[model samples]
Target: MTKLFCILDGHSTPFSVVVSPDDTVDDLKKAIKKEKEPEFDYIPADKLNLWHVSIVIGDDEDEKTITLSEHPDAKKLHATSEISEVFGSAPAKKTIHVIVQRPSQGSSAGTSSQVNSK
Candidate 1:
């Protein structure tokens, strides 16, 4: 099993999960949700978006930068794909490799409730 460090988008701290190379991205999502617990209980695993990113440290010592949707290298992993297929046969350890993004609120139909008044 390999430990993958993942940071939730918009949050600085990262969490880690140990998974096998054969595990699919969907499996990882489930694991992430389990690890995150109450903080993410309302969000389904399938609704979370995972991005492979390379974090760059800015010139300022306190600043860490990451580009997801806007960056070309940020590859969005498919739910069905195996960990090995995406991270290569041997993946690195002790580093943040995945960025977790929650589904945008109200992005899905029927997600938002509107009150119609007379």
Candidate 2:
């Protein structure tokens, strides 16, 4: 099984989840939704975007907190991909490897017209 520490995007605290090598990324998402419970009650498992990332201390010397790496955009994990294939066969330990990004509530679909008013 693979143990991954995931944190909600924009939040610092990390949570843990375990999955078998046979599990898919979608399976991981479902597990995260279950782990988060009421916070994700309104959100579907498929809506939760998972990013394969590493945690690093912020540049600010005074603020000693971990933040997600600059890999979110390029590291979005695909739902159908197998966990093992994506993460390799090694078991993770004490490392925050995934970043969970909740879906945005607001849509920019209808805002395009406003920008085109110029």
TM-score of each: 0.77, 0.75
Each candidate: how many clashes?
0, 0
Best by TM-score: 1
Candidate 2 lDDT for residue 76: 88
lDDT of 1 at 11: 70
Candidate achieving the largest lDDT = 1
Clashing pairs for predicted structure model 2, backbone only: none
**Model 1, span 5-52: residue lDDT tens:** 788876766778878999999999999999998777778789889998
Q: How accurate is candidate 2 locally (lDDT)?
A: 0.76
Can you write out model 2's per-residue Cα lDDT over 19-106, one digit (the tens) per residue?
Answer: 9989999999999999998777777788788988755434342233444454534388999999998888884555678888877757
lDDT, candidate 1, at 76 = 88
Score residue 67 of candidate 1 by CA lDDT: 39
